[model samples]
Target: MYGWADSTAIEVLCHTEQCVVCGDLADGFHYGVRSCRGCNAFFRRAVTFGMQFSCRRGGRCPVDKNARCACRACRLAKCFAVGMDKKAVQPKREGTNGNGIQSQDNSFDQNDSELENRRTSPYFDSVQLTSPESTYSINHSIYAQLTDYTPLRSPSPPPECPFLLRLCYEFSEVKRRRKCMLCKSLEEILTEDCSIRDPATAEDFTVVFQTQMILMFEWVEKLPEFKMIHDPLDKTKLLRAFALRYMLLDNVYHTYELGYNDRLVFVNNNYIIPGQPSSNFNSCEVVNEMEICALMFGAPMQTLVSELVSIIHGRNITIGEIMTVRRLMLWNPGSIGLSSNAQAIASQASNNAMKELQQYLEQEGIEQSEQRLEFLLLYIPALTKHTKTMYEIVRLIPSFGKMSEWNSFMDDVLRGV
Candidate 1:
């Protein structure tokens, strides 16, 4: 266990470094590293265990200002203050390609270097991408812009950090012009196509998807499982968009699509802020809306949504979902009841659950919708949880094989099931 340095009255002042939390440069050691320790721990817990933190009161865990200690998520974010690389903590495989992630070696360094060179170029310098006169704010403006250009495919890992260039903060003295141009142009071109047709439903979907993505991204960043997955530098925008789309599709198939349009209208009517355009929506905000609905219905509805989709659509529905289905689908009968660790227990549980599902299908002749929905509701949570966990493991050490990693983590709990 890591020791907490809160009460030590110890302020170790250091040169400003990049803050892991907001990706801002800090002038002092506010957290564990050059950043604020609060963000460090928040990053650790959030990234390490994939903890879902809720503000006991509600909404926006304040960072760097008020409510600093209130939210676990925010506090850990403070740790990233000085600088906490979730990727740093992730286990490394021997002799991996660029970006230190396990994936097709596509020369991420070359791409990133080229981008960096362009940013430092004299031509781009003359144009001035990040000056006060420039109209774009990389973080706020560019990120919002790219949402319109959500990727349709899972892009291979790129050599550079996608999020870094994809969304940058408004800095007083902007240095890189080429990078700015690329970022701005990419956002402009990509986002041109990403408009929400039905503002209400689309907004809701956007919110839920954002929350999950943040959770997954931050979680994967620190965990060893991140290393096992593709490079974070890949076409991150595209992958993230795909992830978001999958969640939306799952939502539609599970319940949102099943319900009447009136319910959607009512939900959106009550949920959305009156003035804000539905197109300029935030994922967290939408998640809040969906969460409210979940509370109103008193149902663990998210799980059901994924499960229903997975059952109906046989193959792994989303990249995230695929991770889960693959884990569950790979269980061999011979591996059951053979051990007593957490892995064994989980495997056994999955094996048993699958067996029960098979049995349920065989024994109870229920309507397809009812049966599928019921199974989906139960299975989605399990699958998602496992998928999230597996991703965590992979992020830590990309070398971990599918079954080998699963078996090791769960121990024997899943053994001999």
Candidate 2:
């Protein structure tokens, strides 16, 4: 258990890395406190002009990214409450314009030179602040630009978010890029053609499995947190912990998204329909004289499907929901074997992703959204259990048949454990 000081230190470290005014990613030390560029600008404007503000809500309003501009009084009050020093506002710095005339930069980033000097110190570790002439301010413009090229599917999510969008685009890109033997795109499956595919033969399963592994590698490479982990061993360990879980969830959800709630789906055009309780198989559908696929998939996989899918299906989940949840799965900070730095990245990224998930729920107007969020997070444990089940299923693959050429990848995946 943590003592008060320890807990307080932990809390401060977390908050220090985030903007105290509004919980967007911190740009750097702003007015003597860590804050995002937008909040830094807002505070400078408020303090420089000696602007006063009034609250219509008894001076108690939530000031987050979505509502930072909503309540200026509470926002300014919260700024001081969080130790944003008004005294740090230096007189506006002027630079020579194109006309050779000195003009003040309108961007109101107080103490720019000081922040610049501190940026190289061990204390500050965030993206660089915007240059005075760079016009990109609308709360999350920098963050939003990360996902600006990612085309939205439908019913766009809210909270001016990026994690949600980037994750979805990654999933879509991974799924869409893989085509059939005929070179047909799978994008149509999400809308019009999610027909239940027959169980794959051993060769088909091998090909699909190999394809998914490659896709997962590609997708993981694109993630910001994954890129931050510098150690090869840590990267491999994180991927090992996440690989089967990601493939399973992606396969299942992809299948579900194609309008099949009662069955578990896989890409490369195959799926697994749950069997009736106390059932028998021909021992010929997938493996060589072995009741593989659904048989080995068994009770645990069924529970994973029914429990996870029912909630998602019943609740009418959005693209944001599964992708945010996948982000949590991918960068689980508590996942064993990560180095301190890798784990720190995981922890911060996971927290931000969870916060975005909550923000998504609130914007959806879900009744009791916080409680619903708890319900969503509960699946994280279930996902772990399902991943373990997948390991067991993967172990069974070797005994089923003889395709040493096609089976080497699976063998390599299981190695060095």
lDDT of 1 by residue, 1-417 (tens): 111112111111122222333333334443223443334433433443344333332223334323344444333322322234445543212465577766643333345335333423222111212432233222223233333333212233455632221112211011111111112123223323322235443323323332333223332333232233342222122132234233333333333323322221221122222233344334434444434333322233334333433344543222222233322433322322223343344455455544544444444443353455355446644544433322322232223222123222112111211
Task: Give the range where candidate 1 is weakest over 10 consecutive residues by summed lDDT.
Answer: 170-179
Per-residue lDDT tens digits for candidate 2, residues 172-213, read 544533432112111222223546556544444455565565
Could you tell me every candidate's TM-score relative to the true structure?
A: 0.23, 0.53
User: What ranges in model 1 sit over 4 Å off?
Assistant: 1-37, 40-207, 214-242, 253-356, 360-417
Could you say which candidate leads in TM-score? 2
Q: What is the C-alpha lDDT of each candidate?
A: 0.31, 0.57
Error of 2 at 35 (Å): 43
